[model samples]
Target: MVRFVDVPRMRHWVEERGVETVIRGIAERIESDFRRWPEFDTQARVASHSPGGVVELMPVSDSRRYSFKFVNGHPGNPAAGLQTVTAFGVLADVASGYPVLWSEMTILTALRTAATSALIARTLARPDSQVMALIGTGSQAEFQALAFRALLGIDSVRIWDTDPRAMDTFERNMRPLGFSVHRASDGAEACDGADIVTTCTADKAYATVLTDDMVRPGMHVNAIGGDCPGKTELEAAILHRADVFVEYPEQTRIEGEIQQLPEDFPVTELWRVLRGEEPGRTSAEQITVFDSVGFAIEDYSALCYLDSDLGEGEAADVDLIAEPADPKDLFALVAAGANSTVRLG
Candidate 1:
């Protein structure tokens, strides 16, 4: 049976307990996957970009299971009373390619991105770093802040956005959990003198949110935007100046900040650092960049983690597909379930 978990159900599952556990699990899984980096299938995300927005497919699998997410980004959607992005994903059996579970991923995206940011910072950011700069306040802003506060020891953020209303929404959502949140006038102002600078802007164009002039030595950047083909945040100059780290080199090279660089441009994979095959940052003065175009492996890691820790298989499941008792009688189940004795007609 194909099971369905809607957005509300997913939100409860994630916000209540599932998200933190999945993030921690992914961090551990990533570490182990990196230790044996050659074992799994990895590739650049498949994208279909249109004038309306972009839809992307991220697929990844190990020997055990496979997963994929179908996600789209449309900034103008808010005007239509929908979100900027809406998503759903599937978890499937690797051996037979049969879908095992499906869930809404709008909230999951926010959680996983934040989780990834925090995970990368834990590895590359300075040990004593407790402050961060969050540019682009939107639906994702609060999640990023909470994830950092939970995963790292982040205590403060200089928040800035092109839209003050977004900042207001972010601030309001975060009121219950107290943090030293300060507002900044612009992206550069937010990034100034920060230990970790996170960029989560939603624009689909090439906009330079951070110039080389804004960067301080030893700062760790979690570049979350510039994920698609034409979108980018940091100026190309910043790439030249920073020592870059990425989730997967093959994917990052085509989809991440390195897309701006030459074919032979050098960058380090985060797994290598996690695996101790490469150094994170050699000195306090060295700039570190995490060109984060989200990866499918992270999502796969998340789903398996959720599946395992859902407490005695307690996640609600709904029959989203017709089940036939006889394998060849495809129409029987639909016909049987359709007959109703209480029809008003």
Candidate 2:
């Protein structure tokens, strides 16, 4: 039997452990895995795109375990009373080639994405940064806010969204949690006087949610949206002015904000900075951009973290693998069922 965490159980786990605690744990796991960047197999995610949105499979593995997440992003689904993104993932034992855990990843993805953003920001953002300008206050706003607070001591958030209801939802959800939420009239207003700027809009087109004029020196931009071939948020000028860091250069060139630039444009992979081989923030007045496209290894770390904290009582067991009583007698199980039916007849 394989351990399973369905949507309800996953929600329960987060509620019981507290969201910030879970995000902190996942962030630590992500940092640990990134520090050993050479130990895992990493690659760009396999994507199937349509006019609506895209579906992707992100896979990564170390010598001991393998993990993959099947996720979809459909911007129009919200109008149809569905989530814009949903996902499921599996962790397998490499030696046995059998799955050991299966989990719902929609919530976990949100958690890990926030964790990764905060983790990189902690390294790249200015040390005394406090206020964050959140450009898109959709599904990811609250998690981003919480992660930044947990990691960077940021409690004040200036938020803006094209949809008024989204901004309202974000304010309603965050204010009671001891957050100082300020609704901004536009993206520039949101970004004004903020130390860290996070853009997470969901449009699948070449929409410039953040313009060049909005960004300033001494700020870190966590661009978590615009994660596909043609989707982009920041102006190309922003990339030109800021020093960009990415999870994987190969994948970022295809699917991140850097896609707006030339193929030969320079970028630094984040793992190198984490390993201390390269510098993160050389000066307090320099602009930094984390061109996050949601890499596979982040998911692997999140899955491993969840698996480690799992308890038998809270999780269900699923009979996903068929094991024969004898290794050479694969047909015996089926034959036994047939014989029992014949006897009854």
Candidate 3:
């Protein structure tokens, strides 16, 4: 039977390990995978865009296991009484494609995103960096805030967003954590004197949320939200003057900050830094950018965590789909569908 874990149970599992621990574990998995990165089957992703936003499916596996996630991003969803994003995923046996687990991925997605941010900050951000400027204050804001505060020693935060209600939502969710959260009126005010700047806006355009005039040396940017083709958050000028890092090259070139740059522009993959094959910061004054496009391997890392840590929870016995028991008995499953299986009479 496939075990299903809900968000409440997922939250329990996540809280038990804590942010820093989860991030470190993810880093270890990423490093291990990257050491032999060629071993696994990889695909960029498939996306469906509607009037609201976008929906995506990312699938990958080694020879042993398979997993895929169904996630949708609808910027106009909240107004329609739905989460901007809703997701679910499955873990399956690659040998037969039999699903081993079915799990809710909405909360897990948030956790994974936060863990990825923390991992990047640990690898690329300064040691003493404590303050962060969060550009978007929507569903992802609180998760990013909590992850940074827990992992990167970032105790103070300055937040800004186009949505006042989102800022309010962010503040309300994080106030109990006792971090010094400040709401800034504009992007410049939020970034003033901040060590790290995170751009997580939902706009799917090439809007320059952070300009050269607002940027200063020694700043590390966690550029989220600009994961699609037409979406970008940073000014093009910043890329010329900054050292940019990414998770995966082929995918991020079309998704991350380098999407604005030429085909041959220089960028560093985070794994190289983890493996000591590349330099992180050559100078203390050099601005750094982690152009985050939310890679699937990070999701793989997250699913690994959930599998090990998520204890017993509510499970629904749902027959999502099935095949015949016999390897060559494809006709039997359909013939047996809604018919007698056992002979008791």
Candidate 4:
């Protein structure tokens, strides 16, 4: 029996434990795994792009466990009364290659993404930073707001979105959580006097959500929207000005904001920073950017954490794998189930 946590069960688990607690736990796990970054086999996700959106398979493994996620991104999904992104994942035993856990990763992805942003910002953002300029108040807006507040002690957020309804929703949702939510008329206005600028728009084309002129000195940019080829939030000029950090350079050059720059443009891997091999925020005046293209190892960590947490709970179980009574006589097992004792070997 494989443990399965569908959407409803996952929601219940999160609600019972609280979002902040769950996110913080996941963040701790992610940071812990990142410290041992050299142990895992990592690679860029395999993506299938269409005119509407992209479907991706992100996989990672260590010596003990293998994990993968199937996810999709479609900006037009909201208009069709669907989510912009949805995902599911599996965790399996490496030796037997049998699934040990199955889970709905749509909510998990949001949680992990927000946790990752906060984890990175803790290193890249200034120590005194409290104000955040959150552009694009969509599905991920509230999650980012909460993570930053919980992890970085941010007390205020100035948010902006092209869709007024979405901005209103973000404000309504975040204010109850004790955040000073401010609505801005434009992206530039949202970024004013802010220490961290997070762009999380859902668009399939290159967008100038944050221009170079709007950015100030000594600011940290959490760029999470430009996760696929040809989909970006910040302008090319901003990339030229900021010192960028990424998950994997080869993958980020193909899918992240760095895709807009020359092939040889310099960027640092974030794990190196976590391992103290590279500097994160060198000085007070230097601008830092975490060009976030969600990596597979992050999902690996999340799955591992969930598997441990859900193991003791009364989570539902599904018979995902068939068991043969005799290892070598698989057909005999099927024949027995059909009430026929056939002698066929």
Candidate 5:
């Protein structure tokens, strides 16, 4: 039997412990994993793109367990009364090759994404950074605000988006949580006076949401929206002027803002900084860019974090795997159960 943390159960679990606790916990996990990044198998995620959107499978594993997340990104989903991003993931034992835990990842993705950004910002951003410019106020905007507050002591957020209603939703959601929210007239306005600039827009185009002028010295830019081919948020000049860091250089080259740069352009893998193998922010005036194109290892870490929290509250067991009485005679178990259950109506 596979233990399951379905959508409703996952929501209840977060509510029981509170989202801030979950964010802080997952941030710790991400930091720990990044420190020992070479111990796990890593790869760029495989994606299938269509006219509608893109579907992706992100897989990563350590020696003991393997995990994968199935997710899709469709910017038009909100107009269709659906989420722009939805996901579910499975964690399996490597030796047995059998799934152990399965969980809904739509909400978990938001949490992990925010946790990841915060974790990286903790290392790259200046210690005195207190304000964040949220350039996209979609499903991810509020979480990013919360994560910065929980992890980095950021209390003020200057926000903007093409949709007024989305900005309204973001302000309504974030203000109650203690953030001093300010609505900006445009992306440049939002970036003004912000210590950290986060661009998480969802348009599948190479749009310059943040130009070089918008980025100031000593600022860390968390670019999370340009996560696929032809999708980018920052102006290429911004990346040229910043000391760039990434989760995986290969993946980021294809799906992150770094794609706009020359193939040989310098980049430091974020793990190196986490491991103290490389410098994060070399000076108080240095600009740093975390070209965040969500990686598979993050999903792996999130699943591990969720799996460890099992039995803390109500969790459901799902018969997702077949348990054959005789491991060698898998056909026999299926034959035995096929009688009344397979009756022709």
Candidate 6:
């Protein structure tokens, strides 16, 4: 039997533990895994793109366990009354080659993504930063706000979106949670006087949601939306001015905001900074940008974190794998079931 955290159970888990606590826990796990970055197998996610959007398979493994997430990004889904992004993931035991845990990663991905952003901000953003400018108020906006609040003590947010309904949703969701939510007229208005700027728009094109003029010195830009080949959020001039940090350069060069720049453009892998092999923010006046294009290792960490938090009977057990009496007698097991009813055409 394999442990499965279906959508309902996952929601229950989040509600019981509280969203901020779960984000903080996942952040701790992500930080711990990043510190031992050299130990895991890493690579770019395999993606299939179409005019509509993209579907991706992100896989990674440590010596003990392996994990992968099946995810999709379709910007047009919302108009059709579907989620723009959705996912599920699995963690398997390396030795047995059997899946130990399976989870609905739609919620887990949001939590982990927010955790990752906050984790990077802790190192890259200035220590005294308080206010955050959220440029996109989609499904991810609230999670990002909560994660920053939990990790960085940021309770004030200035928000904007091309669609006023999105901004209204953000205000409706965040205001009751004790966050000081201010709806801005535009991206620049949202970014004005803010310490940290997070852009998470879902358009699958080269839209400059954040211009160069809006970004000031000492600001940390968490660009999480520009996560595909043709998708980007910030202007190229901003990349030139800031010190860009990424999860995996090979992947980021193909899918992140840095894709707008040349191949030879410089970037620092976030693991290096987390491992103390490279410097993070050197001065308060420096601009730091985390070009997060979500990686497989983060899913690995989230799966591990979820697995660790499971108590006895907390999750459902599903018989997901076939077990024969003898490992090499798989045919015999099938033959035993041959007597079962079957309808043939």
Write model 3 residue lDDT over 26-120, tens digit each, in one string. Answer: 65665576555557787787888877688899888888778888898876788789997889888888898788777899987887787788777
lDDT of 1 by residue, 1-345 (tens): 655667766766666675456566656655565566667788778889889898999888778788899999997888899898877888889897778878788877776777778888888998878789998888888778877887886869889888889888877776657878888988778887799999888888887888888888989999998787777889898889899998887878777777888978889888888888899988888889999998887777667656665553445666765557887888886685775678876
Window of ten residues with lowest summed lDDT in model 4: 332-341
Please provide, for model 2 over 1-345, each residue's C-alpha lDDT reduced to its tens digit, 9 standing for 90 to 100.
999999999999999999999999999999999999999988899999988889999999999999999999999999999999999999999998899999999999999999999999999999999999999999999999999999998999999999999999999999999999989999999999999999999998898999999999999999999899989999999999999999999999999999989999999989999999988999999999999999999999999999999876778999998889897888876885664445552
Best model per lDDT: 6
Ranking by TM-score: 6, 2, 5, 4, 1, 3
Tens-digit lDDT track for model 5 on 239-338?
8889999999989999999888889999999999999999999898999999999998888888899899766446788888777888787788668556
Query: Over the stretch 1-345, how does candidate 4's per-residue lDDT look in tens digits?
Result: 999999999999889888888888888999989988889998889999988899999999999999999999999999999999999999999999999999999999999999999999998999999899999999998889888977998979999999999998987888888999889989999999999999999998888899998899999999999999998888898888889999989899999998898999999989999999999998998999999989998899888888887746647899988788877877875675674467776
Where is the poorest 10-residue window by lDDT in model 3?
Answer: 308-317
* Cα lDDT tens digits for candidate 6, 84-189: 9999999999999999999999999999999999999999999999999999899999999999999999999999999999988888999999999988989999
Q: What is the TM-score of each candidate against the true structure?
A: 0.90, 0.97, 0.89, 0.96, 0.96, 0.97
- Number of backbone collisions per candidate: 0, 0, 0, 0, 0, 0
Instruction: State each model's CA lDDT, in order.
Output: 0.80, 0.95, 0.81, 0.91, 0.91, 0.95
Residue 64 Cα positional deviation in candidate 6, in Å, after optimal superposition? 0.3
* Candidate 2, pairs of clashing residues: none
Error of 6 at 26 (Å): 0.2
**Where does the lowest 10-residue lDDT sum fall in candidate 1?**
306-315
